[model samples]
Target: MTPEFAYFLKVNVAFVLLYAFYRLFFYRDTFFKLRRTTLLAFFGVALLYPLMNIQDWIREQEPMVEVIQMYSAILPETTITPDNVPETDWHGLLLSGVSYLYWGGVLALLLRFLVQLSSILLLARKSKVMQIYDTRVHVLDRPAGPFSFFRLIFLHPGSHSDKEIDEILTHEGTHVSQWHSIDVIICELICIVCWVNPFVWLLKREVRHNLEYLADDTVLESGYDSRSYQYHLLGLSHTNKSATSLSNSFNMLHLKNRISMMNKKRSHGIGRAKYLIFIPIVGGLLIFSNIDAVARITDELVESSFAEALMPEAIQLPIQLFPAVNKEEPAEMHRGYVLSKEELAAIKRAEEQVFTVVEKMPEYPGGQKALLKYLASSVKYPESAMRNGVEGRVSCSFIVRKNGSITDAEVIRGVDPALNAEALRIINAMPEWSPGEQRGKAVNVKYTVPVSFRLANKHKASVSGTPAKGIDTSGRIFTVVERMPEFPGGQYSLLRYLSQKIKYPVIAQENGIQGRVSCSFVIGADGALSDVKVIRGVDPSLDAEAVRVIKSMPKWKPGVQNNMAVAVKYTVPVTFRLQ
Candidate 1:
């Protein structure tokens, strides 16, 4: 699983357990402030817990064993056959589709978040503000209701009585003073990234509700009449139906629950002990996240097991000989049996022969995806092939032996010879696989894989002839072409022409500048070099000399793309030496 997707899962699991605990033990308790803090803390932990690495802790608890030595004599031989399992294209497509959908959800939610924030800012500007002491009271002339965004409070001044206004201010003031908007924004952000998890939405709702409960309690604690505040909340409920998601609103849903919670008796401090459940819950998540690595280590140790003593020595016993019999007489059978050296050797050879079929196929470390990733990263395009734009797929097959070592790799289908060699080099560098199994014994298996070599995405040069914007076209320059752009003669002659016709710069020779300077240019449809410039420079003198030589040289042919001469860009490196 990707770390990003894993993180989302971990957070949701943490939220489910943490939220469930809250509902069960502390949801109805009168510790409104504590509840708010605890909810925010839960979110903070969920976000950070996934990034922590605890593999070391897990490894420390694993049983350690001395290095095992495999004895060929003790192991029974097994047969293995390569299964032609085609790589699943749909699995890749599904994963890519899911990734796109996830990002789409994130983008949509982010856009919504920004729009909500914009609306809140717009509201602040439209409403008139009156400074009362240290607070800025934004009076919405219309019936937008009361809410707090950061330190600014928005309220419809004309819609509320003086007593109601006083209570609203105290409630929203607590939201601002306690920085409750931070919690709302935090939850909204988390919900945006983890919207796939229903528990995230539930957690956000719980947080917003807890914040409202805290604000309501703050008003009552500041000497407001409980019945009066409750009645005022009911009176405004109809008008205050909607509010910005990333702000603290004076009114929210669940007024009935809020009233009930207020009337309920306060629980003792001992109820906080319920939070202790997090200790084990978090510990379990850490173990789960790091378990895959530990399991891989354990599999390695188990797969390497070998019997301590050789099988021949363990089974060998003193043989008793029977009396010699005449040729005509039948030989008496011995009680104990022993094999001749030749027979024993033959049995050992049979046990060790590479099998053609196996019960379980060999697997690359981290599966096929990881193997592909390694190949993509490790393979380098041959310089000769790159200059000529040689591109195609290379299919190679190799043996994964019983000991998990890769061997006997050969390219079955190849493009250019240079490309084939590069492909083989990468396969040879692959790490060992989990060897194939047959009847619970490890065996050799053959595996085939395909690797493709292609040019990097090309960028358009300033020159014209680009396809019109509306028309679909292959805008990429040709790396390989029917007739490659050439110097006076052929590819081999181009190297000779550069060596004999070119002059090393005097300043470069004096300064001991000795490196290759890479230059790129477009061969126009008319077989003329345009946009000639040094792409990589060793020194100023060397770079100018490389460009000058290429400009002075004659071009005989132009690359053909789509059966027509096109402006194909090319890059070549020129070397400079003191000699």
Candidate 2:
């Protein structure tokens, strides 16, 4: 399941559990049904507030999406693919199920404890009863009454005064009447569930304090001397026995606060205002805790921060805009391998027959040397090519017919469109060569020829270029340049689109355009290019050219690092010069 879905499920379960507890414990007082309803309504809102506004919360924390996405990608079930692809294993699904089970078990135990405590209270109510001893002390030994439920508050034996007994009755009575035991038990459960969240634990502690305040308010309202009641509370200082599911008889904790609160004077005039304050505070909390709001705030903050970090300290504009180059087309046809001896023999016979056919062709106007001479003179080196340098290799494939005629000559490799077209033109213009023969009979055969283009020392000298030696030229420069080949149309198709868009004449030449364009871009985990930037550009025009091209290109199958698609850096060159 998605992380968001999982989170939703978890929170809903928590809310259900909390509601069940509230119904079983806090909502027992049907006399003040409206108060109970109001409390329930507040809790209901609190529980759903986070979910209803989850989108805003996500937007607020924009970076969280990346973090969550990163996490989601690592999970196995997230691998949603086409029906043609293989399905993922069930291990991830099982693990998720197990996590849900564990949390469910915890919630079950909490409910069970609350039920047991309620059972105990019922038992106490049936079996025990409160007694007044000489009016100086009221003792309930194993109180049969629910009012003295789990408590054993000591009445001052020396103070036999009726006022003191009243104070004792009012204080202990407040604890029983308000069902403080239920609050204590519920608070313990809250601590258990939210043990990892410090804020939640703090809230549980506050709930306990509030329960005490609620009981104290009851005691004072019963028409007792609040000061003497405070002294009575101080004198009764024995610590209560800690019970997992029930409130203890005596609690020494918060004694000072309770006594101080009892003494504080409250004007009846402020009651209305105090109640009014709760409306806005609670409403605001509900709004602020809204998941969508929080998410939105987080998203904006993170996106702005991330964008700022990516910007370079120094401002440098790009020189030129390069059009997005389309990816290479798969080889339309691959020459099949000869697997058997018969196949090999047949191939050999064909080669011989074709060679014989080629041998008989007439020499061209400049012969073989003439074609080479033309290539040497026509190819111009660009300035950028001079700086970064350029070398070309040509591979040609041809079929020689039985009559010694060259047929279907194709430039298989190395030759660029302009160069390849020129080479094919010259080859096509030539007379047929002597064809090969098999068993003294001419047969068609195919052959491949590789031609290397190197910058000779003299050629470099003429162009005022320094020869670069020992550089591994094969695959390095060609692979980067040819990384993405033409789509439906050839390179010119892309070039034409870019020219119109950028309004710049982008020419491909052989000699003085000097420099390199390096761009850092994100190939999204999904393999879409985004946030392209020219890290270093020699000239503004060239830089802009590179960025424009990159931005226009279609999505890539992102590079893989450790079997995962990752963002990568690419550098391409655009060389321009005179031939």
lDDT of 2 by residue, 61-140 (tens): 53443433233222221122456657775877987887687678668767876776776555445533446643222333
- The candidate scoring highest on lDDT is 1
- Stretch of 10 with least lDDT, candidate 2: 330-339
lDDT (C-alpha, whole model) for all candidates: 0.64, 0.44
Which ranges of candidate 1 are over 4 A from the true structure? 62-88, 132-134, 296-579
Q: Put down candidate 1 lDDT per residue, 1-579, tens digits, no spaces.
A: 344665677778888877777677766777777777778878877877777776555434512111101121112222222256445567679989998999999999999999999988998888788975456798877796688899879887778877888898899998999998888889899999888888789889888888888888888889999988888888878885545778777777679988887777778888877767767877776666555433333322222221112111111111111111211221111111111111111112334665433457687898644654565456676767655656555666677888899987887667789989988997799898999898898877665554545443231122223322231135445434443454543333565566666677777667655654556787766567877886656788777877887887776566665557666666654545343
RMSD to the true structure for each prediction, in A, is: 27.0, 24.4
Report the Cα lDDT for candidate 1.
0.64
TM-score between model 2 and native: 0.36
C-alpha lDDT (0 to 100) for residue 12 of candidate 1: 80
What lDDT is reached at residue 518 by model 1? 55
